[model samples]
Target: MKPLLRVVLVIDALLLLAFGLLFLLTPWTSLYNALQLAQVEPALVGQGFGIALLGLAWLALHASIDGAMTRAVARTVGHVNWLTGVLMLVWLIALRSPSLSAFGQLVGAVVAVVLVLIGLGGVRLAAAVRRREKAQAAGAGATGREQKQAEKAEKQAAQAREAEVYQTEPVTKVSPPVSPATGRRVEPDFTAAHQPGVVTAETRTVETRSTQTHTAADEARDAAADSPGAPRPPFHG
Candidate 1:
């Protein structure tokens, strides 16, 4: 609540406090004689009013300082003040109660005016406080929604940035190995690939010639052995 509103509440508290003290002292002091205030039949009745008024004063005073109770208490006090003023006006002028003095009538009117004014001030303050609280609540809700939307947008952007994209390439079927010069598909031959050339008739002819030469040398050795037997060898005797 604003300082002005708080000040209004403070004034309300002071007025209530003054009235409470006056009522409480009615039985002991000349307040009833001098001001021609209402003659409460029982002293306890006046004291009871005093106590209730004092309680209201304490509430108003606390409402000025306390944020939680400010609006509710101010509103209540405002209503009660206006109603009490209306009641006083009716009793003093319309009913003209015998208990109230002529001087008390003027005092009641003045007190009623003050009450009405103070009541209006309190009511205005309470309304302003209510409006301010509603505005703050609305602002907070909007801010929370905006913050959530921003976070969601940021999360989506991050996901987009971190996402992986894949690229695909077309594949072709493979063909068998082919010789570049021979225009033919070459089947693999592990045995012949290691050799210098392909085997031919010349390889067989060389093998035959080697065998014939070995046979002629063996025959010559046998003829020498037979001739040595005729010339008589030392090992033979």
Candidate 2:
């Protein structure tokens, strides 16, 4: 509850308590002066008023103690106060008697109107408090939902990143080529032997003839050197 409203409720409770005590203790003088009654018993009227005031005091005190818990009670108290004020005004207008003076009736009417206005103020304050609490609860619920959604989104994004990292391809290492004859790194050669449809029968025949000619020339030279009756060649230093 608001501070100003709380203070007003406390003051109202105190006023009701004081008035109840007054009517209960000094029944004769107070009731006679306030109600202007001659025939009716003052004590009986005082007792009724005292009990009603005490009940109102208790309701007001309960509202002051925990406004949230006793909002309905506070509203009930407000309605009762308004009804009491309206009844008093109605009685003053409908039943005018010699016992009560015009000035006194006017004063009563004014006080009744004041009470009605105060009761309406209290009712309005309670309604406003209830609305504020409802709005705050709704806002808190929305905030919690938003927070949960944000956390879920962050979790999903983290999982996606992990999946992306896991799906990456690995690199393959390659070694340098080595020569077979020299046992060292060398450039590869692509020749007719390695190629398809290049080494034909005509090419093989030409290579065979070249090899036979070289071997025949070497044999002729050896036979000539071994012969005996050949022309003698002059020797020079």
Candidate 3:
């Protein structure tokens, strides 16, 4: 409730409580003379009515203190105030007692107006509270949806990063090189081949084998010429 409205409700409740106490404590004769009533029976009836008003005042005071002047509390207070105001107006019009002085009628009219105004205020407070609650609920729902979307995007991004990391990693396993001379698997000499003016062990072994083959061929040719089945070569000179 607004500060001004709260203040108004507090003041109204206090005033009602004071009037109820006065009617309850004072004698019937005193009340009759104050209101200038012809009947003492009506003063007795006023005491009972005053007690009911005191209860209502207590309810209003409690609602204000607890900050619950909305919804059920507000509606109940509004209905009660409206009923009281309407009844007072009806009594003034229908009864119009000849014993009631001008001052008494004026006081009743003022009280009725106050009750009506308070009733309207209660209704307005309830409506304002309902609208505020609805707006808050809508904002909360929107925030929840945005949070879920953000989490989903984060998960997708993490999965993509993992896939990228897997693709970029180097392969570790490779087949060993085979030696041509022995036809066996051996460790490769990669650095020796890349260096300038350097001969590798595998290349030197291949060169030695080629020179031995040439020597063997020359010896076989000389032996064939010495044999009886060998053919003679034509003279070039």
For this target, which candidate reaches the highest TM-score against the unseen true structure?
1
Worst-scoring 10-residue span by lDDT in model 3: 34-43
lDDT of 2 at 234: 89
lDDT of 1 by residue, 184-232 (tens): 9877556644356766566567678888989999999778878845565
Instruction: Please rank every candidate by TM-score, starting with the best.
Output: 1, 3, 2
The CA root-mean-square deviation of candidate 3, after full C-alpha superposition on the true structure, stands at: 6.8
- How well is each residue in 103-196 modelled by candidate 2, as lDDT tens digits? 7777778867976876777778778777888899999999999999999999999999998888896767666678554899765548665467
Question: Model 3, 46-124: lDDT tens per residue?
Answer: 6886897798778767766676553556657776776778788778767775446788788877888888888777767
Clashes of each: 0, 0, 0
Residue 191 displacement (Å), model 1: 30
Report residue 188 deviation for candidate 1 (angstroms): 24
TM-score for each model: 0.66, 0.60, 0.63
| Model 2 lDDT, residue 138, Cα | 100
Task: Report the lDDT of model 3 for residue 93.
Answer: 62
**1 versus 2: better TM-score goes to:** 1
Model 2 error, position 151 (Å): 1.4
